[model samples]
Target: MILEAAMLHVKEGMEGEFEAAFRKASHIISSMKGYIDHECHKCIEAEGKYLLLVKWETLEDHTVGFRQSQKYQEWKRLLHHFYDPFPTVEHFKKVAKG
Candidate 1:
């Protein structure tokens, strides 16, 4: 499986808006092929910071398939404006698990 993580830096007062938009956007990604699951967590120590975690069957499913799909356009439209500097997404493969 592929694990994708993004550290989102939301605008000062737009954190709530970002969370709401992400909830709606999550539905779109969850319906795609090869999607395993996802979760969003907020940082208690840092305001306006969030973590987006997603699991996929393969990297291509996330990088190519999802990015190339029309759903991504909608995803961007819904959530892109909330970011301040924009999140940098990175994907990794499991090495060891307990």
Candidate 2:
């Protein structure tokens, strides 16, 4: 499995709106090919910060399959505007698990 992580810094005063939008946007990603699951975490210390984690079967499942699909456009429209500086996404493979 491939783990995709992004640290999202939403625009100030838009946190609530962003969360509502994300709930709607979640469905778009969940329906994609190779999608395993995803989580959105709100930061305790930072008012407008969030952590997004998504699991996919392969790197291309996200980079190519999802990002290249029309669904991505909808995803972007629903959630992208909330960011201040756009989040950088990274992928990881599990090394050890408890």
Best candidate, TM-score: 2
Name model 2 segments beyond 4 Å from true. Answer: none
Per-residue alpha-carbon lDDT of candidate 2 for residues 33-77, written as tens digits (9 for 90 to 100): 999999999999999999999999999999999999999999999
TM-score for each model: 0.97, 0.99
User: Highest lDDT among the candidates is held by which one?
Assistant: 2
Clash pairs (backbone) in predicted model 2: none
Q: Write the per-residue lDDT of candidate 1 for residues 21-90, one digit (tens) a residue.
A: 8988989999999999999999999999999999999999999989999999999999999888899999
* Residue 3 miss distance in model 1 (angstroms): 0.1
